[model samples]
Target: MTGDQGTGALAVLELLAQEAPAARIEALLHEARRAGAADAELAELARAVELARTVQASAYRGRDREAALAALVDTAHDLTSPYDLDSLLRVIARRARRLLTFDMAYVSLRRTDGTSYVRTSEGDTTALNAGRELGEGPSLGSLAEERRAPVWSADYLDDDSVPHRPGIDAVVRAEGLRAIIAVPLRSGDTTLGALYGADRKVRHFTPDEIGVLLSLADLAALAIQQAALLERTREEVTELERFGSVTNTTLTRVRHLWDCHTRLARMVLDGARLSTLARAAADALDGVLQVRDPGGRPLTAADELPDLDEEAVTRAALQAHTGRSPVPLPGDVWVAPVTAGAEDLGVLVLRASAALTDEDVRLLELAAQSVAALLLIQRGTAAAEGPVRDELLQDLLDRPHHADLHVRERTRRLGIDLDVPHVVVVARPEGGELGKAVAWSSSYAYRCGGLKAVRRGCIVLLLPGSDASAVARKVSAELSPLLGHPVSTGAAGPARGAAGVAGVYEEAGRCLDALTALDGAGGTASLRELGFLGLLLSTDHDVDAFIASTIGPVLEYDETRMTDLTRTLDAYYESGGSPTHAAEALHVHPNTVSRRLERIAELLGEAWQKPAQALEIQMALRLRKARAALRAHRTP
Candidate 1:
């Protein structure tokens, strides 16, 4: 028995020297009991059991320390890894599971309203560990948040210290989670959320376990903050890029507008037309352009867009004319009014693919203003030239048939060809309408390339045409309405030169008088149309020619035969064709008058006694007696 005891003690010492673990120590102790050792052997077996427990405790502690260190190193590497927020959270949960040697682990972030939702999870098969909210009632995560410290619940479903929720209990039971430990994701005094480790089998949480999870929680908090800041920075960078784009666009448009303005201004200075102005505006704006006149006629080519709205353009133009800014139309069209002083010259319509900015509208307005200025200059020049043209016209038509070199030169300068067939129109307005007539005549004269003057209380125009009647009709029609009175016009034309023009004027004047006598007010006539009256009023009439056409034989017989037969014929007509009354006037005997009458009758033809022939004979004899009296008067 003593030897057996000694051997057992020795074997126990050998086992200790061999560094045998607890299992071998227990097996040897069981064998010693079976062999029924002495008290010393049994005592020695008991000592070995005590020593095995100590060695086992030490080895377990060493392993736990090593695992904790390895877990910390892995967590540090994970935190440094290039992972996004989600990936980082997953890594933290996974690392927490490894660190705590738990079955499951997860991360939860507290919402702004003090509720927590799971952020990431690992080793979870139920909603309990992933995607589940730590409900409003007490939970491991909430406990951690409220205390701003680490918390744990062994048999969480039955822990009285934790405020239990039925739903959370149900999920935990379904996920086979019997214990859970959580540490607040805290920085300083504020808790951001919670990090959790869970186990399927009931387990007690240690201070070291809580400390490891707390470190992970702190790292998670830092990662969450960094992610938030990075996200914000990205947003700021995007906003800056947008602002820079807008600024660049504005600057480019401004430069484009400057170039357009410079080119348009230069064009105006160079006397470009409205069409050119429209084209320049279109080119500058990258659009189609149309310029319209006051009459609504397009001064530029039409746009190719088939759906351009004419009515809308008109309305927009009207609005702009009232000093309102240009209005937008459908299809990205814009209309700006073109005005010169108070006059609305026209509108400018532009069509582009995109809506214009306020700067673009301003550019269009500038173009419109430039166009208005061009129109104003043109009108001013025309207004200034009006009087000058009127003066030149007056010189061309002035009368008295003066052969002055100045008149001829002026006529040439004025573009009047008196040598050509030209007509003169005399318009007489009744009822005190001379001013109106003059105004009308002035415009009419300018349009017709004619000259107007007030002569003999009538508007006289020297026009460049041969048809006097046509001119007279036109003057009467045009001036009558303006004067608000009846206008009578007499035109005489196809006149030879400036010198012969005076004679035509005289004829035209007599025609006027004849029209009035004949109650032909508002009548137009020429010399040929007036018949015998035209000859009487002619300035170029010859008295000798009148006598020859009437009684040429009687006058020739008196001169050739030295007879008084021509005298008898005149006296006979004065006596109503009776020779006896004519003889008494002549102080000659009736027989002598009768013989002369007989001779005169023989010289004159039978048809000369007719009423028409008699009238001609009477006029010729009267003209001859007037000539003889005029001669006697001149000789005295």
Candidate 2:
């Protein structure tokens, strides 16, 4: 072609790229003819236009194919959830109609006799459209099924090459469908059903459009198989339920077991405690409940179970770790192993008048499984966080002054506020059951929004509180039972911020030492609780502060009223707390000394003469005298 003709064709191609109107293209053709373009050049330009149109149509077809693939993928994802067959088939039919622009669409399932009946129909106006049955013959739906491929006809009524079945042909005539397609819904080599789409115009189905129809059929087959399995399962469950309700004895047993299962499942869902499960099992089995860890120590239970044969319980519980069911023990106790898959968590021990029946044992086992699931969840959560908590707590207690902003952020994520008042509690359980003590204390600390760590041989916790002694006693009381031995706790704090924890921990350690030295092991105490020993053993010896605190009121009363109450108090203590003897020591009348003692009681508390208070008072008096005598000896 000439350069001018090539240029004209190039202009037409550019217009096509811009998607110019038909009128604009026609005007351009007239100008080309008026410009004395040769008939051959014009014909070449026509061929270019036809080729451009074909390429443009092909691109549009490719875009449609991409959209169809995406839609089918999304539909497959949506089918991941459960669905009934009728609902799923309707969905498939509706999708087929929309994607292929079919005037009508329907799904048909093949019967055992090789006949197919419409299961679902969409966008159809006929009443017989859905229930329309296609007889067993070499027809549209069966042809696709036998060949395991898609079958289509441009005009079903006029297409003589395609063998048509009377029943299917009758429905097509009534629906006025001219073009129709069918694809087999296959599961492996077995065809379960067929999906059909039809239009009222004589139009040929494209290969890509046929593929889209096949995709919908695949989705329909998956839905059918899933729904079949679902229906079979429901039938089995219904049969069992029906059989159970037939007789009173069997019915009661089944109902009781089912109730137990439901309650336990609900407990796991709602995050109920192990103790709650123990109580539920005990009630269901009519036995006393005693839940024990693998090592034979008793855990918390809903009901207080009596002391049983500990050796038998431990032996049977351990045997249950590998056994399939609850292991029978002496003294009418059954131990059901609690496990998370292959990992043994613990055991549920039941004590009753006699060992439970097989069904009741199963009930107890169900409870054990529930307990296992809950423990596994707890263990998994702790496995991630417990180490971090322990490390942070150890660091905070050991090097509290070094806790910087990063440490603060870590603490914040853990829901711990470092700026608040906190205490350090130390516990040392007897029998060296460190593991049991640590476990119990860790749970206690978490609930209090505090941190726990094992330092030395003791379980230490940094807790939120001001009452150190109270915290100590609570820990000792609660942990002793879990450890199956006595636990002594010592605490010191109400310390604010990370910088104060170290000093408080040291003080708490000394308090523990003082308690043990006083033969108060297995008891709880704080520095102040130790009284004189606390004062002497204190790292920061505030003797003057102690003296002022102990006898400040009496000293102040003496200075303000110019009274000899101090000397009276001194003589009273020197005379063995006897006022008549103190009178002679003070060289005053007994009445006057008695009156001064009463005044002293008013300045101090009413419990001034009490043993604990009297000891503190006498200690302060002696310390004051020692300081004065030392000062006098140093004077020049």
Candidate 3:
């Protein structure tokens, strides 16, 4: 070729780059003909022009692909912003139509059936939304799956080369759809679904257009996966927050429980009153709390609630005792057995005005425990206060003359006033456990501020009282059931000083012996109840007082019956216990004397003829006569 042909070829390339019309190409070919060119030269120049045009068009297409690639990058960024599968799909569909010059767009996620249906649609009005059901019929999605590549159709109704589904064909015919392309939406080896672009007019799809749609589908699939992960993360965060809230509430409740129990423990340690402790616990439990003795007597109360329902409290207490814990009543009340092992100290009762929970019951039980500890301490002190009290009482009773400053200080320390008017009581259990009897006696003595000593099968007590007989009766009444038998008790008192105590103890022993011989010591008695014999044993020895007590019944009977009962009784004892001889002295028959003696026995008691009663009667008769003579002489 010549320089002219080379230069013309270069001009054709420039014109093609500028995208000159076909008229300019023909005019250039004519100018080559006018250049006196040979047919071969002209034809060669024409061929060069065509080759340059092809090269220029190829270069321009490459630049267009570059722009498409840059737009796909921006689309990928926009797809990430959607943050949800549905929204990301919509963005993908919209960007696909705008980037690829389609009139409508839509998206379909692949179902498990391996078929495609329109999830989102744009750019086409069509009933051909169902691409294919692979098992049922051949579809675009199935075809893509089979080929592992994109599928496209120009004039889909007329095209027989591509796979067609009848349902898809019917819808395409109704909507007049022609050109169609579907790209597989893929992430790694998994094919999610297909993205489709279609037009109503038959048109061929360029490779660049198909590439653009495939890139968008890839970005959308990644965005959809990311959205699913983000949704899962949000759910996990919500669950964690809810769990943390529950844990925080549990921790707070535990802290409150610890504080309440700690306060209760401190109250017990500080020796607070039962009422004070109950009040604190009631505040914590939001209820009316009470501490009761084993007998249901209220020891302390936290509120002015209704009067105690003793029956209900007792039933609940029994239930609690059986369980060895707290129990609920018919009402909103609960009770806890206040006990130390098998020994039931008392009960803690609570009447709740608000809802009562297991935690509140736990607080009630703790209060009961505190109350049990206090009661046990008290019982420990009263039942047996070590050996101090027993030893001091035994020393005083055995050797009273040895009383010294130490005894005085010990008595004072033990809350005893030895110098005060006091009584001496001696008791023996009739038939029972001796250990239990002694325990009962010791506890009773301590409660009354007295000292007790057990010596030689006898419980001896020196208590602060002037009435010996009353003290003896109290001991018997209080100890009979506890010791499981009758208590034979005797007392003597109104004594003072160690010497007086010792003397009264002897007198009290004699009284006990006298009662034992007469009544077998099945009951209580004292010198004051015994009569002239008691006067003989007593230090005071008031003869007139003894006479009045010993034969007062006979004297009063004689006065009421208008008979010589006292004189006949004196005559009878004067005749050496012979009713016949006494009748001779009294100017009456033996039968008459016997009748009067029988009446005397009726007035006194059936045992009036026993040795002790007989001796007392004789002494009263002699003392009465002596007192009568003395009064007669003094009056004259």
> Which numbered prediction scores highest in lDDT against the true structure?
2
> In candidate 1, what residue range of length 10 has the lowest lDDT sum?
377-386
**Better candidate by lDDT, 2 or 3:** 2
RMSD of 1: 50.6
lDDT of 1 by residue, 539-635 (tens): 7775675677567888888788888887778788888878779889889999999787667667777667878667777877888899999998995
Q: What is the lDDT of residue 592 in candidate 2?
A: 99
Candidate 3 local distance difference test against the native = 0.73
The C-alpha TM-scores of every prediction are 0.36, 0.42, 0.39
**Candidate 3, residue 335: how far the Cα is off, in Å:** 7.2
The order by descending TM-score is 2, 3, 1
Query: What is the number of backbone collisions in each predicted candidate, taken in the order shown?
Result: 0, 0, 10
lDDT by residue for model 3 (92-168), tens: 88888888887666676777666556676665564455343334567766677556478988777888898887767
Which runs in model 2 stand beyond 4 Å of their true positions?
1-380, 516-520, 542-571, 583-613, 621-636
Q: Regarding TM-score, does 1 or 3 come out ahead?
A: 3
Q: Residue pairs in steric clash, candidate 2?
A: none
